[model samples]
Target: MTKPSRTYRSELRTEQAAATRRRILEAAGACFAESGYGRTTQAAIAARAGVSVESVKAQGPKRDLLLAAFEQAFTGQEGRQPLAEQDQLAAAFAIENDDAFLDTGLEFMAAANRRAYALWRALTSAADSDAEIAPVLDGILARRRKDIESAVGLIQRRGLLAAGVRVRRRVAAELSFLLSPEGYQQLVAESGRSHREYLDWIRSMVRATLERMEP
Candidate 1:
């Protein structure tokens, strides 16, 4: 049998590193969800990931791990990317029809909220006492607000917004509140609503709000 080339070996190493990083992030997320951020340590994450403590440390500190885990949860991926950079949102915005836009946009938001809701709860609960987490929380909120505003801007530009809803600020705020993780937790997690039911409810609410404001 022929041996693999150096390039192939290098690619293999890169893939292995990525896999390890993903495992560490997954373990950290589980630890945070179960124990809360205050109680979750690097050592705990290391053990949960079945890697050495030094391996976890090489990834970064606990704060970095928390941020990475949250990113993975929200994006359903390992690497960090801005919300505005998401191709799904861009595709949704490109959809000219209001119904299509709302459907696709709500679908994306609901999926992300479903994946991240538990970790979001853990982070919010921990942020109350952990000052280190406040910055990450703030950054996430700011990005969410920006994304809401961007979506609203697209709708307004398409002349799909309701006539009475002239204020972008108010519309953005309402959408943000409706699409928040807390709302998801309440409806889907606590109220026993299926993911499909929750998404349909959001779609209905968004359509009604937009129709009522349609100029």
Candidate 2:
């Protein structure tokens, strides 16, 4: 029997490494979400992932792990890329119908909230007292605002934005405030609203904002 080529072996190792890294990040996210960042430990994450503590530490320190896990949960990747540029939103961005685009955008927001809100709540609490985590939280919020602006720009380009919506920055800020993870945490996680009810609230608030801007 012929042996596998060196190049094939190398590729297999790379895929395995990527899979291991993803597993560790996922475990870290779950730990942070359930235990909070101050309480979560590398050992705990390793136990959750069924890997060694050293392997978890090999990914990064706890702060890096929290940020990476949050990013991965939020954007489906551990990077600083804007949401407008992410591949996950490509199909939604390509929708030419304004109604369809709005629907897709809301669904995307709902899905993202479902995936990341718990971790986001953990991150928010960590930022309150952890000096190392505060800046990271600021950066995440900044990126979120920029993403809202980008979405507004896209809507304007498609001629879907209302004529009365003259101040885009203000509009973006309103959207950011309205769609904050804190609100999601309160309404869905703490207040015991079902996911569908939370989504309906989002749709109502967003539509009300848009309606107010209609000329």
Candidate 3:
């Protein structure tokens, strides 16, 4: 059946908006990655995008900053699938890349981890005493959940997730650690493994777990 005209236009508009948002996000990501969340201000992010501070604020409120980034980072896999729908097992199997599915999957996963970790560290630290920062922290976490849920849907469709494990709970934990700058930095500071090596270990372990539960 042919799709509706309005649907197409709506998609086009969304694509445009997303593109603009992505430009801003990529810039913000670089800043956050380098400066840590506490150090990077919205003005710096706007400068990276060559836009004004007000434009950045208008583009999205500070609370929505990470949300915008998370939305852009993942390819919209709203990967949640009910366990009962074993028929759509294909959803769980991600990354049809020639470069080893696990490797590619973890590459994106690490990217997501870095972004989320920055948000988490900033929000959590801010929320320690300031009540105003509470909502911003919640907003960041809410977006992360949405993205992970999308990933979970893909896993359910492909049945690639480990069996017998609580899907939502497991995804949440994996995402939490995978994109955790704090955890990554801690491991780096204490364990002496380079970032590249640490990510490899992470990717391998996550994939192995999937193989055990779903393969």
Candidate 4:
């Protein structure tokens, strides 16, 4: 049997490294969601990933791991790009019909909230005690607010906002609060609303907010 070439060996190593990194990120996300940031240690993450502590350290510190997990959850990948820079958000904005835009937006938000709710709650709980985590949580909220504002802007540009709702910022703020993780947790987790029911509520609220402006 012929041995593999050096290039093949190098490619195999690269694939193995990517797999290791993916495992570490998945393990870290589960750890953070289950244990919160303060209680989740690098050693614990390594154990969860089935890798050595040295390998986890080589990837990055615990903080970087947490941030990477958040990025992965939100953007469906681990990258430094902002949420607005993503094609998903751009596609959402490109939606022309008012009803279609709102439906698509709610669907996307519901999916995201389902994936990240536990992780976000864990981070928010950790933020109260961990100063380092507080800023990261704040940054996440800031980005979410910006995303909501952008959506609201698109709605307004399409003349889909209600006649009485003149202030775009206020409308964005209200929509953001309604679509927030906390709201999702309260309605879905605490109040026991089904995901479809919650999304329907969102649809109703959004439609009520813009009913007068639908052309």
Candidate 5:
């Protein structure tokens, strides 16, 4: 049997390292979600990942880990990319029918909320007390506002948005509040609404927001 080449070995090691980092980030997300940032320790994350404490430390400090984990949970990768450019949004935009496009958009938001809500909760709580986290939270919010503007542009192109909605600032602000994680948390987590019920609320509220705008 032939031995693996040096290049092949190098590639394998890189893949293994990436997988380990993913595991550690996932563990970190779980810890932050369950215990909150104040209480979650690297040792706990290491145990959750089934890796050594040294390995967890090798990744980063807890604050860095929290941001990385939140990014991964929310976007399925680093948070470097704009949310609108993601493949999921592209797929949703491909639908030509206005109502169908709106439905797809809502479903996408609902899915994202479901995946990231817990970690988002942790992130917001941490931002309140952690100076380092507050700037990151602000940056994320700014990015989200940009994303909302992008979405509104797409909706305008589809001729679904009213003439009044062409002013992106006002519309984006309304949409941001409508689709906020806090609203999701109150509806689904606090109010005991099922996922479907929460989605229905999103559909109704967002649709109303769009239609009620003066032309």
Candidate 6:
């Protein structure tokens, strides 16, 4: 049996979908970058994407929309996949090997800083709880934690981690620290350290912690 070829119009449709999704993400990232989390809205993201508000809504509700935008910006990929690899997750977190831990973690903090704070505030305040965003937010955090595991594994592999670090305990704690939005608000916000400085400390602290636990 012969397989049917994709019609030209069908191919065009696929391309258009790709472009639309990209536009939504780019606009969301730009808006979030400029306005912080509290100010950005679906209408704003739609305008940024050059689409109707309905289109943005159809693309996703608030959680999905934000997740889509952040994932794209962080990983250079579509929404989260089930079995993602370490290097890929690292890329999604915007960390390259060329980036020192501080530099890479700092970039991620900048991208996530406002959004994380805002989303958390929303979770606590509105509806007396987050009706929908909680799971999405949790998923994002889980992924980030996994990225730390990947990074810690790399450190261990290279023997950059100290001689006898306990792998499981260190990875768990480091993940908790890196994934905590409260840490961001306290250190990056109230502590008066610049986001860059705090992130550097996070990297250094995590590395030091992990190295100390090396086995």
List per-prediction Cα lDDT, in the order shown. Answer: 0.84, 0.85, 0.59, 0.80, 0.87, 0.62
Question: 116-177 in candidate 3: lDDT tens per residue?
Answer: 54544544665665566677567656665765566555565565664343765676567556
Residue-by-residue lDDT tens digits, candidate 2, 43-147: 999999999999998998898999999888877887898887777577889987877778778877887788899999888898898899998788888889889
Assess every candidate by TM-score: 0.88, 0.93, 0.53, 0.84, 0.93, 0.61
Worst 10 residues of 5 by lDDT: 160-169
Candidate 4 residues 74-167, lDDT tens each? 5677885555566776677677776676787788788778777777887778778878878987887887777777777777778876433456
Model 5 C-alpha lDDT per residue in residues 1-215, reported as the tens digit of each score: 99999999999999999999999999999999899999999999999999999999999889899999988887777656888777777788898887888888888888778777889999999999999989989999999999998888777667777644446667888989988878888888888999899889889988887787634
Instruction: Please give the distance, in angstroms, between residue 155's alpha carbon in candidate 2 and its true position after superposition.
Output: 1.3
Pairs of colliding residues, candidate 5:
none
In model 4, the runs with Cα more than 4 Å from the true position are 1-15, 162-166, 212-215
Model 1 pairs in collision: 162-213, 162-214, 163-213, 163-214
Give the per-residue Cα lDDT of candidate 1 at 125: 82
Which candidate, 1 or 3, would have the higher TM-score against the true structure? 1
Higher-TM-score candidate among 4 and 5?
5
Error of 5 at 6 (Å): 2.2
Q: What is the lDDT of residue 177 in candidate 3?
A: 60
The residue-by-residue lDDT of candidate 6 on 118-179, one tens digit each, is 44443334323445756666766677676556555565655556433466446756656764
RMSD to the hidden true structure, all candidates: 2.4, 1.7, 7.6, 3.0, 1.6, 5.9
- TM-score for candidate 5, residues paired by index: 0.93
TM match of model 3 to true structure: 0.53
Poorest stretch of ten by lDDT in candidate 3 = 77-86
